[model samples]
Target: MAFTLPFFSAKTLLTTTTTITQFPENPKTLILEQCKTIKDLNQIHAHVIKTGLLVNPTIAENLLESSAILLPGSMDYALAIFRSIDEPNPAAYNILIRGFTLKQSPREAVLLFKEMRENSVEPDKYTFPCILKACSRLQALKEGEEIHAQIVKFGFGTHGFVENTLIHMYANCGKVEVARRVFDDMSKRGVITWNSMFAGYTKSGNWDEVVKLFHKMQESGVVFDEVTMICVLTACGRLGDLELGEWINEYIDMNGLKGNLNLITSLVDMYAKCGRLDTARRLFDEMPRRDVVAWSAMISGCSQSGQCREALALFHEMQKVKVDPNEITMVSVLSACAVLGALETGKWVHFFIKKKKMKLTVTLGTALMDFYAKCGSIENSLEVFEQMPLKNVLSWTVLIQGLASNGEGRKALEFFSLMRGKNIEPNDVTFIGVLSACSHTGLVDDGRNFFVSMTIEFGIEPRIEHYGCMVDILGRAGMIEEAYQFIKNMPIKPNAIIWRTLLASCRVHKNIEIAEESLQHLVRLEPTHSGDYILLSNTYASLGRWEDALRVRSQMKEKGIKKTPGCSLIELDGVIHEFFAEDNSHPHLKEIYNATENMMKRIKSAGYVPNTAEARLDAEEDDKEASVSHHSEKLAIAFGLIRTSPGITIRISKNLRVCTDCHTATKMISKVFNREIVVRDRNRFHHFKEGSCSCNDFW
Candidate 1:
């Protein structure tokens, strides 16, 4: 094989190839072929400079055409070559203008057009559309009108591309009326022109016009694009029209349009907000791939529907799939924690925030503080507040509320003062927190000053909540008549809470007449709540009005309104034990009952007398004693004593306010059992020790 072939000499091969030419005769075609990419254009420019043909007139014109049309941003190199010519033709200016417009440099395009006009370069039909596109992107309405005049001057106004871009310019610049006028005046229109008008209406949020235009396009037999479908779906979402949204979904499915994540996410959110969570979940499940947005929508829907546990479960499941959580996800999860009082879980979220280095924006920080506060971690709530990089009104309000609810009223009031000192002007909610603190701590004078300052200093008009706090403060301080007078003079009508506060104070002071007046107003506002009727009955019983008490109970029965049974729960060793009135459900019920009986004996011997009158039973003395013995807090304490050793604090949370008989019994039990008992009811906390309550029998 090596000896089979003969090789030609280099001199003979060069002489043979000298007769052939490799390039085109027209340099224009050669230039166009050479200017394929930016690097190729540069190489051609170098070759042109080396050939000494750069100054040649015909070659320069051809170079301008090749560079401008072949490469984007080649206009600059082409313009340099064109300007080097002493007298460039109109075609050169047209090439530069079109290239500038194509590069989205609209301002420069307009400037080039001006330079061309000053140089007396006549524009052709192609020149008008390019310049009009530049005007549209720049939103240069006045300049666009000038271009329109030029178009009419050039007799190209009726041209399709020219007229379409004019419409786009006017519409995009918020001159839709002008756009419509142009469209109406047009002798002929294309699908691009109609689409421009439709998109203009959509951008203006004119949904009705968008729909009308869409129908008009359909009547004209114009085809729609994916952009149109997405836009209509957005409008439907804004209207919360489930019917329309479903129609659009069905249309998309029937058309077999490839479903994208954005469309699916929007549909899910719209359905969820319209109270169609099941449908939302169905749509979400049908998605081929679940993004973070899809997961967040489902989690938020669950939270909004009061399914906090389910929302939390979904959040954990999201983590298992390694879908990174964003601000929206964290906010929804934190809200779920707030509703569930999930302290440990909320803390873990906080830790995650730190590990991820997420910015604690005002809203996110407020949500975190709210979660901690609601979960009964006021200290952690305060820490979150202090560490916040930015503080809004809500941040300050949540911290103050947390402190007030945790019985740190003094600290709450102090923060309110600090807020004022910092000139963080107080709003109505700020006053609510401060007034609530005053109510909790019995600072009547401070509350009155803040209430007055609300209108006088801050110009914040007082609402019903503010009035309620004022009434509560006075009522809790044993000024029942004063609270009644305040309610009478309130500018806004007193609500159930205002009247209820008065009735509660009346019960405490044994004032039957005031209780009757408050009860009358309460029943008129909220007649369905059984607690209101029960409170009124208890007030009557405390006043020895057995007939009125019996009448109230009978009316409740006739209305099919049953009083909520009082139940208390205690947490011990990470387990919660619940007890109800007269409950014997525990396995060691016998032992618990015996232990409670013995404790009661010791309590009575220590001077604790049962106040059955507060029960409003209207029974014989023996029956009243039995009724007092079967209270839920007594049962909880009995179970606590049987289950735990002495000297440990017993914490119980009751659904309803503790009755006077149970309150007295708890104080005595604390002393007899040598334990500190903490009872949290709907209103506030009661700390009992050594046969006395921390409230000094005032609460």
Candidate 2:
């Protein structure tokens, strides 16, 4: 080395020089490549400061740009570095504004743009799109228009991206016509521009316009994607145009989109809701993957169609498939159970929830409680309700309804008071439940107070349900005239239920004139329901107006309508047996008939006297007694006593209100057999014990 070998020394020197200048050749590019995301950018920034390169203006601007794009809140950090420069360019300002738009703080973006303008940082074509996107999100049409003028003044309106954003802004802000004008002015429009306009029309419920625009886009050869198909299907679904929906179904099939879960769900819901359940079921079965939503849709369809058994079976099948049941699924299943009076099945679901530790969401708990209550198992319902750690308005409402249905009307009132004491604000549903309790218990004053408090204290306007409950409460308490006046004073027009409540009361109190008036209102409101006509006929017969009753019956015949036959069910030893009035279809019919006849004779011996006139029968006294002997409740009760021990309680559920004869017969039978009888009818529960009813003859 000391001898200075010239070739070897020259080689060593060249290597040293190459290493020293390699980083400087592309220092800015190296810095950007290092800073990709927020964390990486911060680390690189630290490296830049440590390496004494922070003072380089080019390096500093690159850092600002990287941070603005990579990190959401890094705009401020970028701006701090940007301001340190001697003079920043429009690129720096544009980066900051775009960052703000990405953060959804569109107002801040526009403000920063203005600040940039004041600082003499002129915007380029890139700046307008970011600003216009912000305007579209904010729906600030006026601000967007001002920006549009500025874009034209700057000669950037011809930029396709800038023009498309303006179209979107106007379209999103409900200015579709203006958006169309801007789109027409565009020398060239992008696919995004067309999509924005299509979405706008769909959102505005302009289904026809949506279809026309979709066709136009297709004609222009724009390829349809998942998003476009979804929009079109949603519009068709909302319009309830089965024909259009069918067309879309065929389109999806032709396109080989059967794997799309969202599309399948939408089609299933559309078909089911449009009264095409068979088609919906076919689609649902064809799906390879069935989610909880698909199963819930099918169950809801069955429930609405009164196919309770099918709904319940589907719910069970859903569980067997291990599809996790959500709140909606629980609601549908519970509604099905309620319809079928499937108390045991409902109980199993309640147990399943606890076994699985499913979160007791408010809706799920309310639905479960409602199912148990309707199925005549209020005790179990209360157990589930009390175990809930959280209670909302619906929880209280369901419990109140359960208590009322179980003839624990006083307990229902107490629960309402407790709910108020706990400072849990009551909603319209809670008030409905409370009023229902009062009506069942004949608490006229309590019901009135709740009705007044609904408007005066809670600011909840009374709906038709509340008005109907009030009428029921007053009518049950024999205030027939007041109930009629209350219906007259309802702010909203009285619906069938409201007028029917008054008519029912008139029949109870023997107010024939009031009953007639209420009947007229009912017939006008619900002309298609044969039950309403039959009820009016019964009311006329109650007052010995046989001709008037016959006239109502004639109208029913002319309308091709018939009343639903009264039926009752009794559950014994985990088996349910059903009986219908005037029906002799049971295998044990002869025994049931003989027992019912003997029981009637014994009940008459106990001072019952076969009060068939109370049933409004248009027959001889002897014939009336014979006819009333075969009433459903009478058959159910006689069968229960024959089957069960003398001291055991007999429980029966009737599909209709307990007729006057049945009520008297139940009381008499309870005393004669020395056993308690619980009869849950359409309206309320009647506990017959020791020749007395819980309703105190008030119902």
Candidate 3:
């Protein structure tokens, strides 16, 4: 089977059976020409064999290369032809090497290179570049380095193609420093070299270095292209540097390189991330073409900027345009639903995910879990947790927090135990949830133990949120003095939230002395926040010190502070109904008022008494009673009672902590109607059932 004839001689190779005028005179040239199909190649192959050209190396190599590259499913035939050559050259070995690499079989190329070296077929410049490409694809750093040494030994290191390939190999292998060293050693740098290095830095998240390298390239007067612009915009997005990003945009305009899809996408992302949504959207709308990435950037930007409703609306619009949402789009959409507490929309999204057969990755699964938890769907949250095949620290923490938020503190603690049994180490957020569970359940001792274990056992230093939770635990349990003392003895400086926690607790427990102390610190820390002043003023009013209450009110008026009006949300028939204090502007305004009056009468007869102390101090008794009766949450609840079907649980979300009168009214309504009511206020969830609350009337 071995042939050792001259490589490409035309003298003794002709033995044609057909007419000689039909094909090229040179057999080598004819083999290199394009064939329409495998059938055409087989005919030409038959011609070559009839011409006695099987002994010529060039004809054989060309046939093998054409079959390996152009003809699909013919690499086996190419390999057979390659094996038949008695002493194959490097060019022959390179044909199969490149074929395997192109077919995504990098290991095969490495193996063939080994065979070629053993056969003493010295590699040329072409041989080095092809094999190095295979090494880059495989990320075989050791093999690539071996090739590098051989390149130097063969004196082919000076070749531009070889040098560029080397740079790419090191960069792709994550040895950016080594790649940089190679770049520094190169005497002739081109666009490819700079792009390779910039891409490496970008992959490693070294955006500063990318900017610095780009500056150096500019100073060196090297020509910049679209790829360079993309890398620069990415750096701007990461750094939130709007100034430089704009400058780059100007440069693009000046250079007349507009309408580049990738460059436009980068600019959109950069402006959006830099907190310039208007500019980003303007640029996005002006783009001649838009893709999924452009739409996702806008949606994600809206979600991050606290425009969750806008984000969801845009997602709907994106679908109408027939652009399918990717996983990231769904994640952002789910987050918007969580913020809006739009359970129905979230369910639709979940169904869409299933309908599209989208795989629930850990991140997407975690986002869904968070959405359900915040939307008051603990069952769904737990279901996602259990169904997820993989769990990270965030997954475990979200589930724990969800349980705590739903007033299932005991269950949250038990889940934390299970998490530990699985050897999943708790992070700071995990312990925050653990301590919060104890706080909600009034397990003071458990809270203390977990707080200590956070630092001693897990080495997670107590963050301000953790300390605030501990203060809330003690303060809510009528230990206001202890909470104040705890703040004074803190290792780090206590924040305004800690003092605010103590002040709010003081208001509930009527600890006027410690309330004053906490308010002093709170006012100094946050002078403009109206909540602390309102809390202290309420403390004064609760003690019947009208003058002191008036004094606090005067100070607030002088400082131009106003209390945040309470707002409540109730979902009815998949639509959220919002109500503010004394709000009577609903479309069914008369019916809502009539329902509130009827519910008030029924609850009053059922042993519910109006707690008028929450009303304004300057108001008369009648006015106080009227204000307490028409509070935002009561209005929302009355609307729910009128709109929802019988025996349905009512869920409401509040902007501020529920007032005492509204809390009592909801508990009575829950008992009289034999319905369970769940209210998620600013602080914690209150589950009212049968004249009882999950918080044990503590929050």
Q: What does candidate 2's lDDT look like per residue over 572-661, in tens digits?
A: 764568899866899899999998888988988889876554332344656767777788989989999899987987878788878777
Error of 3 at 320 (Å): 1.9
1-699 per-residue lDDT for model 3 (tens digits): 222222232443322233344555555554554453555467667756777776777788888878888678777778877887788888889888999888888898999999999888899999988998899999999999999999999999888789888988888888889988888988899898899889888887888999999989999999988888898898998888888899999987887767787788888888887888888889888988788888888888888878777888889899999999999899999998887677888899999998998888899999999998988889999998888889988999999998898889999999999999999999999998998898888889999999999989999999999999999999988888788889889998999989999988888899999889888887888888877877887788888987787788779888888778888887676576788887867788788888999999999999998867677545677698888888888888888888788888888888888877788899999989888888888887788999889877767
How many times do residue backbones clash in model 1?
0
TM-score for every candidate vs. truth? Answer: 0.61, 0.63, 0.78
lDDT per residue for candidate 1 within 513-614, as digits (tens), equals 898888789889988888788778887877788889889888988988876778877655534566787776877688878988888888889888877755
C-alpha lDDT of candidate 3 relative to the true structure: 0.85
Best by lDDT: 3
Cα deviation of 452, candidate 2, in Å: 2.8
Error of 3 at 456 (Å): 5.8
lDDT of 2 at 662: 85
RMSD of each: 11.1, 9.9, 6.2
How many residue pairs clash (N, CA or C atoms closer than 3 angstroms) in each of the candidate models, in the order given? 0, 0, 1
How many residue pairs in model 3 have overlapping backbones?
1
At residue 177, candidate 1 shows an lDDT of 84
Best first by lDDT, ranked: 3, 2, 1
Lowest lDDT sum, 10 consecutive residues, model 1, at 1-10
